[model samples]
Target: MRGFGDLEAEIMDRLWSWGRAATAREIVDDLQLRRPLAYTTVTTVADILHTKGWLRREKVGRAWVYEPTCTREAYTAQLMHQALETTSDRAGALLHFVDRMSGDEASALRAALEQVKERDTP
Candidate 1:
């Protein structure tokens, strides 16, 4: 899967941050605080996101409420996986990636690896 476009990323960021369903009008209003955006434009983009399977929508009263189909973390992981798939040497790429991580991030990676190892042990 590909990453979100500019407008798509804005909408997704708001929905993921709120952690709740929202209508296009609500999103437009929130985004308006940062920059001018038309309600119709936001609605169209939101509809596109729904068609792309990045969002799920339900008709509530007269408005359609939209929510993210997956968390931001899931999207980031998918992007990372996609990046790895493009590399000829995945291990070398991963090593370079790890080398750029902060101490806390490195520790977290180590902890996560240990958890996966434990889970895979039979």
Candidate 2:
């Protein structure tokens, strides 16, 4: 969240969702909001992702196929860790975050945790 741009987020989502390597054109095709972007733009973004250590690339034929280096959950956890590193008041920031979530969101989180616990225990 913190280290990503709009395009980066979109591209990462596409790569992670596919769970496979993809070229820039392949990434562009998955975008729902169709916009005229040159192939260079996508390549540049993919390169930037690689530079940021969020993506890994492999040359395939004439194109470089890119894939996410980390899972979505791992990336999110890293972002949270970065946030904590930046904040002096970690407890206060966490309290504020919990305060902002709606009751339904809290319940959903609890349910997800319970499911994970059940799976882990049994």
Whose lDDT is greatest here?
1
For model 2 the TM-score comes to 0.75
TM-score of 1: 0.97
Superposed by TM-score, candidate 2 places the C-alpha of residue 66 at a distance from the truth, in angstroms, of: 0.7
What is the alpha-carbon lDDT of model 1 when measured against the actual structure?
A: 0.97
Candidate closest to the true structure, highest TM-score: 1
Q: How many backbone clashes does candidate 2 have?
A: 0
- Give the CA lDDT, 0 to 100, for residue 109 in model 1: 98
Stretch of 10 with least lDDT, candidate 1: 1-10
* Model 2 lDDT tens row, 25-77: 88877673577667787789899999988999999898899989999989987
RMSD of each: 0.8, 3.4
The lDDT values for all models are: 0.97, 0.86
